[model samples]
Structures are given as C-alpha cells and as structure tokens.
Target: MKNSIFFTALLATTISLASCHNSNAKPVISNEIASIEKTSVDGNTKIQVALLLDTSNSMDGLIEQAKSRLWNIVNTLTTLKYNGKTPDIEISLYEYGNDGLSAEANYIRQVTPLTTDLDLISEKLFTLRTNGGSEYCGAVIQDATKQLSWGKDNDNMKLIYVCGNEAFNQGGINYKEAISDALKNDIYVNTIFCGNQQDGINSYWKDGADYGKGKYFNIDSNRAIHYIVTPYDVQITTCNERINNTYINYGSHGYEKKQKQAEQDRNAGSVSSANYAERTVSKSKAAYKNDSWDLVDKMKDDEKAIDKLKKEELPEELKNKSKEEIKVFVAKKSKEREAIQKEISELAKKRQDYIDTEAKKTKTQDDLGNAISTSIVSLAKVKGYSVEK
Candidate 1:
C-alpha cells in the first residue's frame, strides 16, 4: 500500500509541471502579438516646413515652376518612408517682393502654419504671383524668426526653404545674427540659389545656411525653370540612394548590435531614477504647500556669498550699529536692483520697436496685394471680361 501511494504522488507532480509550462508559453505568444500591433500604430511621424519664396520680377519662371511642382512636392513628402515609417509633412508659404514698398516689410505671412492639409497649401501656392523688388534676405529671416511660431513641440522638425535669385546679404540686419536666432529656435534654413549668378553668389547663401544649421542647394537657373514640376527629385533621389547604400553596406549583424545597445541605454534604471528625482523636486517646490521658505533660504545664501566677496567691506561694527548704516546697505541693494530692472525695461522696449516695425511692414504688404488684385481686375475689364473680387 505505501509503494502505490508514492507512485500516485509522482504522477500528479509530473502533470502539474506540464500545465505550468503551457500557461507560460501562451503569455509569450500574446506579448508578441501585442508588440506587432504597436509597431503598426507608431509608423508615421510629423514634419513642419516653411517655404520663403522670392517673387522678384526675375523669378517669373521660377514661380511658375514652383506652382507646377507644388503638388508633386507634397505627394513626394507624403510617400517618403524612413526605416519603414512614413512622415506626414505640413507646409507653410511666404512670398517676398509681394510687398511693393520697404524691403524690410517683405517677410513671411504664415500662409499656412504647419497643417497636414496639402490641398490648402497647394491652392495658396498656385495663387502666388511675381512682382519687382530687391530681395532682402536678412529682413525675411528676421521676419520669419520673429513672426512665425516654430518649434512649439520637440517631436516636430521645422525647416525653412529660402528660394531667391538675388544675394541674401543685402538688408541692414546681420545675416549671421538672423541665422543664429533661427537656430536657437530650432528652425533649419535651406537655400535655393536661383538666377544667372556665379557660384560665388551661391557660397554667400551657403554660409548663411551654415549659420542657420541648414543645407544649401545651388540650383541652376535653367534647371530651376525647366524642371518646375520636380525641382527636388534629382537631389532627393540621390540622397535616398546614398542612405540606402550606407545601410546595406553596414550589414544586419552590425546594425542589430548597435540597435540593441541603444535599446539598453534607453531602458537603463539611472534614467528612470533621474526623471523621478526631477518630478519630486518640482512637486516639493509648490508655493501652496508653504515650501517657499526653501527658496528664501537660497536667496539668503546668495546674498551672504556676495557680501563675503566685497572688497573693503564694511566693518561689522559699522554694518550692524546704526540706522544710517542699514539705510546705506538697503539703498545700495535697491540701486543694484534698479539697474537690473532698467536693463530689462530696455530689452522690452527694443522688442516692442521690432513689433511695431513689422506691423507697419505687414500693412504695406497687404496694400500691395490689394493693389495687384485691383490692377488685374482692371486689365480683365479692358479685355472685355467680368472680374470678381
């Protein structure tokens, strides 16, 4: 009877082990299925782009080319894939030379502010017309830098394409300063050098782009005019081919090793710990919790450090003894604060001046557009056709 009981216990243990293994295997399969679903959902990233166009009299053909190719550019961007992920691109257009007066006012008018609606962008592009003026690239950059809302979020990539036939260094504002500001705001400027100019002219634009952390394209005038419907194809295709070749040359084994290392870094525990610490510190500083005293302590320490560094410092007897001494210290501190406040006030005034200048320029541009539309209507009337505003 003892031998039969022991044999029954061993049989039950073996069945239980088999059932546990089957349950674990089912979960592994479910996790794999869920991962596949996630991969499909996270495939498309978004891009924000701006086109700074030159509407100078010399760019009539360039404008025509751009209109013809606008749809093609949108289609190409929509279809682009990097590492099996598509990029949804949004575009904005701004035309220089559209404003007939002061060159400073001829900057970007939001045309479209980063929207995925390609149809609307295309329609606006088609409406752009050429006018006569000197291209002030610095003004355009300054205008774009200040007016356009760019880089509001980290995931979006902002690009500016400055297309013009003239030299980009003509305006009073420094090109390097404009470019630096754009880079600070995370806006990349690409140059499309057009017209019958030497390669040296292209170099100037290239330098400006370098300052802006952008790429430069030297497009021959003839090519720009003739290849209107697909101005970017040759360059885009070449870039894509080079990228593919580089990836293939690196071999799958090498790529996998690099990818695994990246994954490990992303998942490391130290990163999570640092993020938690930051959150805790932020929460602890909330004023409603009566925690502002900690900030006051920091300020006191800062003031003590400054006092310790002073040369020919006031003797402790003089410092602590009289109301006159306390008054002098308080007055000195007040003066220092006043100086800082004055500097801030000056900066605010400068910013306001810039805004006022831009506002005046915008009014001029509006008037120019209205005048052009009116002139077109007049011409149509002379040709015996009814024109509608």
Candidate 2:
C-alpha cells in the first residue's frame, strides 16, 4: 500500500502542434453588467486545477518530475479552444506528509492558492522539501474542495489531482466524503497512485478514482524526467529574453517579480537547456499572464486600469510621463509583446512536431507528466474544448 500510494520509477526516454487561437485574441466583457458584478462576467472560459501532492520522505522524485514537466503541461493546455475562444487557466498547489509541516493541521500545507501566474507555480514547485510523515489523502482532498473558489459554470473544467503513497483509507476523514463534496462542487478528482498499477488497484486507488468520477493513474515516481531537445529551442529561448524586456514593472513587487521572472528562467535553465526553452514556449501562450505586476498584463485585464494608477506609482520609465504618454508607451509594449509571443507560438508548433516525431521512435516512461496530460485531454474533451493542431 505504501509503495502504491507513492511514485515508483525506472528511467527511460521522452503533444501535436497546436496554435493558440490568434495571439491577438482579447477577453470581451458583456455590455449589460449589473453594478454588483463585473469582474465575473468576462467572456473567457476557465480551467481550474488543484494539485495535491504527498511530500513525505520518499516522494522527492515526484516533486522533481513536477518541476521538470510543468511547461509541457502548459504547452498542451494552450491549445484548448471552444467556439474559437480560449479559456483562462488557474492552478493551486498543496503539499502533505512532510514532518516540517504543522502537526495539528495533519501535516498538510496549501503551498499556493489558485493563480494564473504559471511562473509562481514553477517557483513554488522548486521550493518544496520532503520530510518523513503521514500522508492524509482524504483530509487534504476535502480541504482543497472547501477552500478554493471553484467555478460554478457547468462548462468550465474543475479538477483535483491528489497523489500520495499510502493506503487510501489511512486518514481519519473518509475518502468517500471528500469525493461527495467534490461532486457537489462539480469538480473531478483524479488519483495518481505513485507505485505499481497492480498494487494501486489492490489498495483501492482505482476505486477512489471511480467514486470521484476522475481518471486513475498508477505512475512510477522514481523515473528520471527527460526533456526532448528540439531544433527550435535556441530561437524560442532567445525570443523569451526579448519578450522579458517588454514588461513595464509597476507597484511594489513589480520590479521584484520582473527579476523573479528572470530568476525562474535561470532556474529552468539549471534543470536542462531544453527544459528552460520549453518554459519559454509556455510563456508565449495566451494563458501566461501577469496582470498583478506587469503594466502590459494589467492593461490587458482592464483597459481602464491605467486610470486607477497614480502617476507616482508608475515605474521609473513611465513615472514622468503624462497619462496619454504612458498609455501610448504601454500600447507599444503590448503590441511588441504580442508579436514576440506570436513568434514563440509559431516556433512552439515546430518544437511540438519534433517531439512527436522523437516520441514515436522511443516510448517515454508513463510518469506524472503523461498521467496529468492524459487526464487533461480526456476532461477537456468532456468540456467541449477542441484542439487545433
């Protein structure tokens, strides 16, 4: 049961080409809006994901796999479209079973709330540390369902991917109860058993997935993650550096997050050049937005957001400029960003082709990356999202 609940692995090695709806697509808000509700009425659809991982002593490989393949997941998600409209994507993270966590809280921590900033997700994934402790699978699942602001739209995709290395019945809370609550929230709960498939089935991991109306995956967590280096990698990586310079930093953490963006680039590069480059492709997609810090993204979120900004709050580059000057400056940067992102999106298609060709010759190990992606494809179809390759 312990082995089945966590990842088991052996090493071996690494989507189709899909263009995000045009890079110029914009989120349109309804003209008829009540005074009380404006932010919630955007035309953009959404895919909300809650990731709960067991961080016990033996799960180090699982965490590493997450860090390595995070971009590929984003890369695939960028292809989603329904009626030619793209969806907003948000992800939340949770860790359980590390001895360093609060004991009274059942050794679980919500590492980050649901957020659209993919870089912050990558940053948080890199910061996880494993320690010995009990993994309360049921309790953690329930917490995410209750705590997160899940979408009420029946068409939106909502999911919980909770993985652990223990008996499904180990925790005090009932796994059935957790699944019931998830059902109430219209959220699908997928279970990834970290060990052998047979062992996972015997331990009722498959049954848990059944009750939750989600996919059942038994992944070998110990497997080494491999990123397939592509011909377009260099050009894609270079474009990301160019795109980074276009961001106009403002607010308190504006400059800080801008640097952090570069820092994560280095962090991804540390893993492998291919990994870093793949991250850039994901960043190029429409899903990667930083409205909280970058003026470019802020304006995209709300065209009127510039009026809310005080002149002193502007970045040094725009501080002395009048509102009209700042508007023109931001518009120019926004256009430049779109062009760079368009180039990256085009290159990403070529990169995906190279990966698909390579994958046919060599079967990549079915690990966390494949598991999550496979489930995503299945659920996405259910939500009426079509993939344009």
Strongest candidate by TM-score: 2
Steric collisions counted per model: 0, 8
Local accuracy of candidate 2 as per-residue lDDT tens digits, 259-364: 9899889888888889888889887877887877889988986888888898767888788888888899999999999999999888989988999999888987
Off by over 4 Å in 2: 1-43
- lDDT string for model 1 (193-267, tens) is 764335625548878766776665554443422211122223222222222221110121334433432332233
lDDT (C-alpha, whole model) for all candidates: 0.43, 0.78
TM-score of candidate 1 to 2 decimals: 0.43
How much is the lDDT of residue 43 in candidate 1? 31
- Name every residue pair that clashes in candidate 1: none
Task: Estimate candidate 2's alpha-carbon lDDT, on a 0 to 1 scale.
Answer: 0.78
TM-score of each: 0.43, 0.88
Model 2 Cα shift for residue 131 (angstroms) = 0.5
Candidate 1, superposed: residue stretches over 4 Å from native: 1-45, 81-85, 99-104, 107-110, 200-203, 222-389
